[model samples]
Target chain A: MNVLVYGAGQLAQMMYLAGAPLNLNVLAVDVANKTVVHPVEKTVLPQSLEQAINDADVLTVEFEHVPEELLLVAEESGKLSPNLQSILVGADRVREKHLLESLNIANCEHEIITDIAQLDGICERLGEKIIFKSSRDGYDGYGQWRSSTAADLPELKNIFTKLDLHKVPIVAEKMCPFTRELSLLGARNESGEIVVYPLAQNTHHEGQLHTSIAPAPLLSEALQAQALDIFTRLAEKLEYVGVLAVELFEHDGVLLVNELAPRVHNSGHWSMHGADTCQFENHLRAVCALPLGSTEHGPAAAMINIIGCNTFSKNFLSISGVHFHWYGKTVREKRKMGHINVTANSYADLADKFGNLSEYLPMEFFPKLLADADRIK
Target chain B: MNVLVYGAGQLAQMMYLAGAPLNLNVLAVDVANKTVVHPVEKTVLPQSLEQAINDADVLTVEFEHVPEELLLVAEESGKLSPNLQSILVGADRVREKHLLESLNIANCEHEIITDIAQLDGICERLGEKIIFKSSRDGYDGYGQWRSSTAADLPELKNIFTKLDLHKVPIVAEKMCPFTRELSLLGARNESGEIVVYPLAQNTHHEGQLHTSIAPAPLLSEALQAQALDIFTRLAEKLEYVGVLAVELFEHDGVLLVNELAPRVHNSGHWSMHGADTCQFENHLRAVCALPLGSTEHGPAAAMINIIGCNTFSKNFLSISGVHFHWYGKTVREKRKMGHINVTANSYADLADKFGNLSEYLPMEFFPKLLADADRIK
Candidate 1:
């Protein structure tokens, strides 16, 4: 079967590798140029984007923010998935908040603001401290504003007005002191059979994901169940097919929705070596209407992100049990370079081995010296 | 590091896949035409074989029968592994039998018959029941003769004389009735570190391996230990580097060496999904002077060979936990098409799943009807 994925990026490249043995023909379209190319074939140009979509048995997106018009074309032919409405929810905070509220899901109390005057009302309703976020194109802590006190709110509101907040409505949320961040990656087939991978504990630095540990050691059974419950409710509500990642913040003992990704996600990259089926392969299987793979963990896993620089001179290749995935991307400042998955017999052992990662990893990139030590330990 | 392998068959393809993530650049050299190519890059050109060899950090073979001149070049450069002597022992029965005898290892009783007169002397010494084998280029039950009666012996001797057996030399053996077949896949590094995976119970049809079960289910502890002993001794004797596979036969409870593969063997294919580090990866690691990967099995795994003519149908996509690997070979008659690995919680469960393989797999291509049933129970 042929599959056309919108966006030619690392995720699409990995999907191509996983699909090869199954005899699944895959062409990735870089919407900007409307050029279709194979990830590994690297040089083989296929039909035009429109022609490729016409030949595909299924069409999907690597990222949610694909242009609406292109998505409409795919949807018109009944091929696009998670569908346009679902993609919009993930792209726009206003729609995302509405969906969560409609489902009665717990999220930080918030209000949509379109103008400086609306921001003042939102601050009054939320609290003295509020986080302002653009409803669209905001990611990695970008397109945001913060008001710590009532006196500061008016100035922040003025700044929002100058930026034309009304043109792109913002979601103002009450800032909460959450203890930890967790994420649930679950998949559902068209048949509605759903499977949830274990919750993952995520850590980030400089607004980019730093690492994630699977089965999120020390997570209570109640917390895991609650995360899965939230995923099941959202997946069923959207009639979702393929993998969905729901980011959560644990405030006190309650989990609040932070964000939702309607496609395979970064937090689940550990599954490539740790789980019975990787999220990419499972997503492909689910989208192809095949039985979902077993999501059981084979070993305790820890994933550390490789960001921007590649100068860790300790020789990553020297370590046993380390699987490095280089995305073959041209490195730029703060760009995601690749990741390393370390699997061990036990969570404690994995932590212990990773503690010595500095011996092989270049430490200059990870500025949080103590944080690295604490994480692996 | 770059490695130039001397064959472009399945073994070379698997080695290429295993070496890729390690950033090891592996180029396959077509021995027939002396052309060089990369499996993933899939580019072939008329470069001098010597140039490809000069480009590699190390030189190796997927199979042992590379032309002696190529082996000599690699040997002169101190890059060839298992060396020409060790590889020649595996390729020629005369040298293999002589080496075993010199080491005081018990093997099938045989005589080196050069003519019809020598055959009669062989029968007089080892009795009427015997097998005749060519000293070189024999595999998959090819290039050998079998005689059960005296009348057949005269014609076999005549055939040997016609082929000028004296110049090539041939080994005649007293055929032994063996209860079962097994193999040991082990690796030895340049630093003298050795790691052996569990012995595998193998079943063959028409001399081609059909399936393998790890830990050789139901075997006594003594036999397993003896198998390891044989492997250790053989590895040390040749100072072998990289993975070596030793095929064995069990007569009653005693194990006897059948054949040896100096590279990753078909019997170890299960390691891809079953073991922590597959044989192919470990072989690459050893050859590159890198740390070895774990060989721990996730669960009892049963690997079924998908030979030619047994094509995958549309419904084949429905089998969960079944990992399929298809080699893009165009030839259809009796080829090693691909393989399907089915991992289960237990041996019985795996056997039960293997039984249902026919529903998704075409069965006529397999010579033995009970192959699916007897794989792993």
Candidate 2:
């Protein structure tokens, strides 16, 4: 079977790797250049995007931000998995919030603001502290504004005016004093068979993911149940037929939906080394309508993102349980070059290895990781 | 860094997959066509073989049977790892036998026969039971002839005469009465650091590898020590700087060297899912002169070759611990298409999963696997 991915990025590269072992041909479309590259075969034959899509048995996306025109074309072909509506919901915060509210999912209290006048009394009405995010085209802390206190309102208003909130509304959310960030990754096939991975505790640096620990050490059964319940409800409600990641916030032992990513996620990268079947492979399986693989976790595992650096010594492999995954991309500031996934017999052992691994990583990209590792014991 | 592989077969394809996460560009040379294909980027741009070799930081072989002319070119560039002489020794049975004798390695008693006349008294002098092997270009039971009794000498001599034994001498070996087959895989870097994987118990069918169980189920410390000692001696002797596989025969509790493969071997495929570092990745590391990763084995693992079949349902993945590796080759009778690697907490669990996995594979290609799985308990 052939699969056409919408975005030609690192995620597509990984999906290509995973598909090779299943006798599936995974081709990625360069959305901008309109070219197709077979990530495993490493070949860019002379084929148009329309021809490639027509040849593919199914169409999927590596990320949610694919151009709407391209998605509409794929939707017309009736081969796109997770559907166009789900992709739009993931792409636009306004649509996503509306869907969450309709489903009665407990999310952060928020209001949509299209004009500066709507922000006049928003601080008083909601709270002094709130985060404003662009309704569309934002990621990794970009296109976001925050009000630390009432005194910062003028600066927030200035930022809102600069962002041209009239063209794209902003989602003004009440900042919740949550305990920690967590994410749950799950897949549902066309047959409605769903499999959810263990909840992963995540840590972010400058709004970009830095570390993820699977099965979330010291997790309560109630939390696990709640995460799965949320995943099942959302997956059924959307009739999703591929991997979906739901980022959440933990407050007073209750989980609240933070956001949704409609694709294989970085936080789930630990599954490559720590689970029986990885998220990438499971995503392909769901898209192809194959039986889902097991989602059982290894004893313990952790993933550390290799951001903005690709010059580490291979000596890091000398550490017992450390596995490096370098995305073949040119290095640049703030770029996610790759990641490392480590598995161990116990959470303590994983933490110990993570600590040892941190010594080899660039301090600039891994400070949050080092702190997290030190707290493992 | 870039690596140029000698062959564009599945081994090279796998090496490409392993190298991608290391930020290394792995390109394979189609020996016959002299065309280069990048495995990960899947692009076949117009580049001469010399230019590809010049661009590569290191040169390695996917299979030891690479054309000698190509090896000479890579050798002249001073980029070939494990060196050209070692590859010749692996390719020619005569050279292999001489090396084993010089190193005092235990091997089957054998005599080199240049002509049919030299084979006249070979059977009588050695034993009624003997096996004849071509000194070059032979694998998977091809170029092999066996005599079970003295009466079969005339037919063997007739077949030998037809084979034109003058150009390439045949090594007449006495068939050792052995208990089982085993193999050891090890990697050596230019820095002289060597790490060996645990000896694996192997089973062959029709002279092709069928299944491998890592840590050899019920291994003795003495057997492991003996295997590692042999590997260390051979690696040091060859000044080897890449992965090597030593196929051995166990007879009366002692190990006898059967043959050696200068590249990754089928018996080591289990490491893909069962070892901390797979043989392919370690081979790339050694070739690139990087620190070798750990060779620690998972608790228990098994690998079953998927010969001449790609029709199995993906439902096989529904079985816990099963990981499929399809080679993306067109189906052909008796051809090695791909394999399945499974890992579990214990040998018994591995065995149980193996039994469950067999139900999904074709009986024609996996009869021996079914029988072996039945005996796992």
Candidate 3:
């Protein structure tokens, strides 16, 4: 079975690794160049984009931001999974928020702002603090402005006025002061079978995921059920055919939907070592229409990202259950060089591994390593 | 780092899959054509074997039977792990027997037959029941004959007389009555550190491996210690720097060496899903001079070989903890198509899974599947 993924990046590379054992030939398209390539080596294969698509048993995306033109070509082939509508919803925050509201899903109070003037009564209606984000991708996407206090509103409004919000709408959401950020990752097959991993508590540094603890320590039964219910509703509605990640915020024992990622998300990467079936394998299983693997409960696992640093010794692998994954990409500021997955029997054990791991890494880059380790208890 | 593996077979393909996550680029040398190729796809790469060897940081072999000329080229690179002597010993049963005798290791009582005349009193010295195997691999190799009683000695001698026994000597050993067959797989690093996985009980049918159960049920501490001691002695004596497997026959409470596989062996395939650190990864880590991964014991695992068959339904994967591994190879009579790994918390649980898996498999092809499952308890 040949699975062609739209993005030639880490997730696709990981899927390639996972798929090999199952006899699934996973190829990646460098959407930037529109050329089919080997997922891990990134070497150009002797096949045009169209030919690769024609050869693929299933078509999927590693990221939702794949160009609309290319997605159309894939969608027209009738092989793409999760379909175009689901991917677009993940790409456009406005559409995402609308879907959440229509489903009666609990999410932050928000509104689509096409003009800067709409900021007027926003504070009185929603809250004093609000974050504005571009609804689509590219430099225009993930673009953000925050009105944390009354004094900051003038500068935020001035920054927003330069953009034509009509062309690319912005979603203004009242920032919830949540206790912790968590995410539930699950896969839905063509047969409508769904398997969700335990929620993973996330910690971000400078807006990038820094650490994730799976089956997040101190998980309440209610929170677990709520997360699964939310995923079930959204996936069934979209007819999602691969792994979907729903980012959540926990505030006062209540869960709120924060974002949705249509494809494999970074927060689920820990499943590579944490779960019986990693998300990458489950995603391929779901997309390729194979029997879904079990996501059975296992030991506590922590995934710590190796961002923008590559000079450390890998001697830390001597520690039991530590897996080092380097992407083999060039070093650049804030680039995800690789990640280290540490599996332990208990939260305290995971914390100890982190403390041991912190000693080997360049401490400055992993500023939150020790902190997150201590938080596990 | 690039690892150039000799012999583009399933073993090399597995190594490629295991090496990718560690940022190791693994390529295979098609010794049959003296060309470099992708291990899994078997596609000819755009590089000469010489160039591949030049570019490789480490060189290893998937099968010890690789042509001596190719082994010479690989050994000349000064990067081969397990070294030339270790590989040679594995290829020649005569050398293997000598090494075993030199170390005072208990193996089958054997006699080296260089000429038919040597068999005159062989039956009297060893036993009436004897099995002879070619000392090397080739058309004229693995040539075997068995003499069960006094009446069969004349025919066996007549068959032996037709061979150029001097050029290709044969090892004639008295077949021993054994209760069980087990193998210990372990890795020795360049640092001389050794780690061994729990022994896997193996069952063979028609001279091909049919099934294996890891940490063989009802294992005694003494048996485990004996196997470990055997591995450590051989590895340290050879100064081995890769995974080595020792096949053993257990009689009463004693283990006698049966054979040595210089590279990863079929019995160890269970480690892929059963052990915390699989044998392939540990082999790559050893040859690459990386820290050896932990081989801490875990759940019992069973590996059932799919042989000469490709018509089974994969729905058996619906059973929890069942991992199906297909090698993507064209099936041939008696060829290993792939393997299925089933992990469970105990022997009884493993037996139950085997019962479920047997339903999805072609029972005719797996003659011992149900019987072995019953034996597990």
Tens digits of per-residue lDDT, candidate 3, A56-100, equal 989999999999999999999999997999999999998898899
Model 2 clashing residue pairs (backbone):
A41-B42, A42-B41, A42-B42, A42-B43, A43-B42, A43-B43
Model 1 per-residue lDDT at B2: 83
Worst 10 residues of 1 chain B by lDDT: B366-375
Chain B alone, candidate 3, TM-score of: 0.98
Compose the digit string of candidate 1's lDDT tens values, residues B104-164.
Answer: 6657778886665776566678777888777877333337778787667877865666676
**Residue-by-residue lDDT tens digits, candidate 2, B13-48:** 889888888877889998877789765334465788
Question: Where is the poorest 10-residue window by lDDT in model 3 chain A?
Answer: A139-148
Per candidate, native contacts kept equal: 0.35, 0.76, 0.78
What are the iRMS values of all candidates? 2.9, 1.8, 0.9
Candidate 1 residue pairs in backbone clash? none
lDDT of 1 by residue, A24-113 (tens): 666788877778876543444747877888899988888888887888898888977667777778888999999999999999998888
In model 3, the runs with Cα more than 4 Å from the true position are A139-142, B139-142
Instruction: Pick the lDDT winner.
Output: 3
Q: What DockQ does each listed candidate score?
A: 0.40, 0.62, 0.82
lDDT per residue for candidate 3 within B52-112, as digits (tens), equals 9999999999989889888888888899997999999999999999999999989999999
* Clashing residue pairs for model 3: none
| 10 residues in a row with least lDDT, candidate 2 chain B | B37-46
Q: How accurate is candidate 3 locally (lDDT)?
A: 0.90
